[model samples]
Target chain A: MTEDQIIAYVDGELGPIEALRFERAMEADAALAAAVGRHRALRDRVASHFAPIAAEPVPARLAAMVDPSSNVVAFPARPRRWFDAGGRYAAIAATLVAGLVLGQVLPRGPAAPIGERNGAIMAQGGLAAALDRDLAAAPENGAYRIGVSFVSRDRRYCRTFSGNAGAGLGCHGPEGWALVRFVAGSGSEEQGAYRQAGSASADVLEAAQAMMAGDPLDADAERRARDSGWRLR
Target chain B: MSSHRVAWDETGEIIRFILKAVDGTELRTSDVTEFERALLDLLPRLRRFARALALDAADADDLCQIALERALKAEAQWEKGSRLDSWMYRIMRNCWIDEVRARKRRSETFVAEEEGLAVGEADDRRIEARVELGHVDRAMAALPPEQREVIALILVEGLAYREAAELLDLPMGTITSRLVRGRQALLEMLGEAA
Candidate 1:
């Protein structure tokens, strides 16, 4: 048999008959037995060389893709868009929420005008009306001061409002305007006047600028959307 | 099937025990199939095979990542009641041939830092063993890529000659001959009197 026979026999690649035949040849020739021994030694050495790699912990980047807990299809995670950063009410904490004013979001009561309907934080009474009406795009002198009106990245019409009720960003949803991001100007809206950084609406507008999908709605688009009852076009 | 998983878990018993003490890595509830769990179990072995194919840990992981993506993407193509390990091996080998191997040919560099990192916690004896391992690794690298792959399949990975041959789509004689040449070179490099 050639050297390949010795290599294959040592690696158990030989069939039963071939292995037995090779064993007989090894018994006959002492040098052949030594060659077999050498082949066995090499295979053992090399197996040891590479086997430890199997024991190393898989890298987290690679492991994350197969993690059953995660949505493996999206493991690497999509890049956050600049316009949608700290905006869009997907996950408040997941986005960069460094200095946003999220004041006691949607505190519900008989006197309070915000309520949760079917798990959605709904803007009740004047707040919802301000988000719904043409007055949202009007000048600063309106009753419920609308800082800006724009469509969110999700195509929902949203308005930043501050008044006697409270100040926050509310996006129009099926149930009504949902309080997506809140300004901490609610209960403290009386004498203390819900001022932190500056006027609540100013903070709302600034936060809205960072969080808005685009520029605040132009007067024409704002009027048209308002006339159509604030439905996304 | 759960009993089989328990058997697999036994291999990771120490790891699980440590994770429990540290409150690390709780598997969240998801619709995990036995097939998926089996694939998860094969990762370490696939990584070993990947290391045998590629140059460094990072490159091997990149190759593994590509293989995993393809494996999951074409998961429906995999046959039931067959060895998933072999199927995954085929997928990894294809990834190496198609993507990583071509990329590596353009700029291949041996990384000693990876070897140092592998044995960061090694004792003196283990350090000496690591030195020997490094020698073997260098020797394997010195081989032609073809011979190196053959050596990886037969010697390092312990595939049968026929299995290696079929997996590579080469004749058995060609595969055996390549293994013999690779082993001879490796033995000589290691200064074994073969």
Candidate 2:
């Protein structure tokens, strides 16, 4: 049997003719049989490792999303101004922003997404608010595009963003949205996604992936995070 | 009576209505039908497949959400006679590749991607099941992305070879070759055989 056929046979990928011939050869050859055994064992080992996630209870956010009832909700208008001084919230999920702003209404548009405070990089203006409340695809138009929200290995909530503010990652901590890594933005629309444009995004994503301790929050979990002011227990 | 302002919830995440229509329009569940239900039923498996692709739980679900949104939007276009699972997997895999370009990965060492999001593994049985799961998780994580994808679809998810090949748009030989490379790499990392 060819090497490919042998592997395919173990994977049950071989055609019947190929599988039959492979079996004959395997019986005659102990080393080949042993090799197949190892391959199968490894397959079983790896499959079992990942299979539990499937068995795990589906996250409520995800389950709610696919429910025909939840999926059919009206597209309430998108708010232009996410932050305002009035007692009323201008947008959905603005209640989560109350604790974030600390009762002081922040101004709009002028402040850049990245700023140096206490000699450390911090997210300013809309970027700060977006990191605190924005979902992955939500409007961060006033500042930058928030790509992915993940818990850093150190358990701090971190996010990746690109667009006018430059492509990089920032983590939320005592100092607010502290910039962990930064890459110069090309300021291109397609590149704004922090993906698929070039090696720059790959670098940023690698950093995010390295820093992430677990899966990034799905929408519901992100909402829950925002609801609780992103405090990890 | 003409206006139907959708009330935003206090938490403001779950939309409170499924078929509420505006302007006193007749409410309908026509959008859901069989497509949405089938999509919901396949969610668990799709999440597994997506997790295989995205390697992060939240990213996988986000990827899943995007794909589902697309699928629901294009429900009429789906060939109903075909397997919904395969079709949805196709959408998800394409969505993952297109949106994030989660490609260009060259790592061959474990970097700790999404570890266990164990839901009910605390019992005595799961503890036994987890004895080698960590080691296996590391071995699988050490593989190059290409090999890992094949291994995930074929060996881990148990898709038929042809199904995986067609879903990925690769030739039969190419699929087998990737399976071979992936299997050997996995075995090598696992220290089962060369």
Candidate 3:
């Protein structure tokens, strides 16, 4: 069998019985075997050339994309108008109220809570005090990173914290830094390092920004705030 | 639609799962379908496309989020036996194109190159292979949008030639020709033995 015969055989473009006959012929043909092998190798080379993508670690944010239910919330079908704006805001307020209800009413495990805690510092109690009194006392290190302390555009005092429990942002609002998000591996739960929070991780940073009051608190401001007893407004 | 009834509860559960992750909403019974199950199952592939298209992992995930939001919003339109994968692929392609176009407008100097898109997780041999793959990616990117669409449908996606041709609204010869040219270029860049 020739190279063309093998290529045609592999493509299954040949008739079924003819394909079977070719397969049988290849049993006795060493040269055909080598040729077929090369053909398969080439096909795989092409496929793998594009297929490594499947093996790469799929970023979590992408994985979080599941089809959102239409029932969740509906935005204006058309651009907002003066008349529509009021209706839209009303609808949004209603949705927020509903979300708030669900968030509050839902029973939660220690690991996963449904809604943001208001004026609550819900860290493991002993852990919280240790961080406030001890970890906060340490100087910043590039290696032992404590993310960032920023004053969000919204006047919330936000900070990224990492230690044994993992890295997450805590901010001062009606509820104080109720662990807005705990990013896995962002920090070891060792409760002792100071790492800078990445300005990436939009959801975490956005929460930080949403709670922020103005420009970020500089290192000097952070030190003074810590010195002045780290009060929450 | 019989399968709709056959797995009504299961379908509802899957819808709930997706909804819980996306937004805290409850899906009505009428909103479930086997087509959705098929679409949700393809999330990994969609993420792969996102990573391939976006420069940074963060942006890739954002693209995936947007794509998911779009797919869910348009879920009601998907009919059974209509090739859900292809429909989802079209959605992903459109999302990526829109995002790239927006980014392009924002930054005149930006170019979306495959080399920068790699996650840098592999070894030297794999890295070399990935660079070769990057060339194929560029060659595919260089084709006319129409031809590139055909290659993605028929070749990378493994769709039947006729099905792909139909999906792209092109003649069968056009798909074959585009595929041939695409494959030939890829082989040349990677070497025949590769």
Task: Give the number of the best model, judged by lDDT.
Answer: 1
TM-score to native of every candidate shown:
0.49, 0.46, 0.40
The C-alpha local distance difference test score for the whole of candidate 3 amounts to 0.49
Please name the candidate that would achieve the greatest DockQ relative to the true structure. Answer: 1
| lDDT score, candidate 2 | 0.59
List ranges where model 2 is wrong by over 4 Å: A15-17, A68-233, B1-31, B99-133
Model 1: how far residue B163 lies from native, Å: 1.8
Residues B88-108 of candidate 2 have per-residue lDDT tens digits of 877877786565332223111
- Rank list by lDDT: 1, 2, 3
Q: lDDT scores for all predictions?
A: 0.61, 0.59, 0.49
The digit string of per-residue lDDT tens for model 2 on A1-233 reads: 56676667777767798788888888999989987787777777767767877765555566556552231121112121232312222221222222112221222234755555665657777778877878785654555677888888898888887665346678888878876665444234554333322344565788789889989888777777777787777
Better of 1 and 3 by lDDT: 1
Candidate 2, pairs of clashing residues = none
**In angstroms, how far off is B172's CA in candidate 3?**
1.4
Give the Å error, residue A139, model 3: 61
Name model 1 segments beyond 4 Å from true. A68-233, B1-28, B104-133
